[model samples]
Target: MAQSFGTFDIAVLDGGQYDPRWPLIHMTPEEAVRAADDMGVKSMILTHVGKFCISAHSWDEPFNRVVEASQGKDFRLLTPKIGKPIRLDGAEQSFSRWWEDIN
Candidate 1:
């Protein structure tokens, strides 16, 4: 359906798991934003979030940081519900702040 919806963008980096950038594990939020920008990505989707206590910085901290860093950046941040299908019709996508509803 590239002809139908049009090609949106390339690259979806994992922008979570922690900071420091050592041990070469996962890309932090800030780092991910930078990388995406450098790669000239137009849109990004951050998923697999809202896990229970994976890191010490709360369940939603990393995701929060990603949102903060994405502002004024080159690409758009798309936070869809985990396991949900997101239609890429070249139209703007909106998602509810599910984390805010958490206890």
Candidate 2:
């Protein structure tokens, strides 16, 4: 749906809260990547995370899995801080593994 726009090349996906019982409601890392592909998204930013234990995976799992799933893909997976700016030109490459310290 997002690919309808000529400039809508980036997709900010909902990467939080995944459960096998409700696959239709939540999107996993792989699923999100597939969606980006479906929408012809050139870059992807994962949001709606860092809180709420709504699934089996840990809080940090989403970012990690997204990174893993993005292997060999043409699109970029961006994970930035709350206030940090994400470059629309896809030149700024910064990814903070913020959840590594948390247990």
Tell me, by TM-score, which candidate is best: 2
Worst lDDT run of 10 residues, candidate 1, spans 47-56
TM for every model, in the order presented, reads 0.77, 0.79
What is each predicted model's overall lDDT from 0 to 1?
0.70, 0.78
- Residue-level lDDT of model 1, residues 29-73, one tens digit each, is 777777777766778875435665455557787678888888997
- Give residue 51's error in model 2 in angstroms: 2.3
lDDT of 2 by residue, 21-71 (tens): 988887888888878877777889876577667788878888889888888
The parts of candidate 2 lying over 4 Å away from their true place are 1-7, 89-91
Worst 10 residues of 2 by lDDT: 1-10
Candidate 1 Cα lDDT to native: 0.70
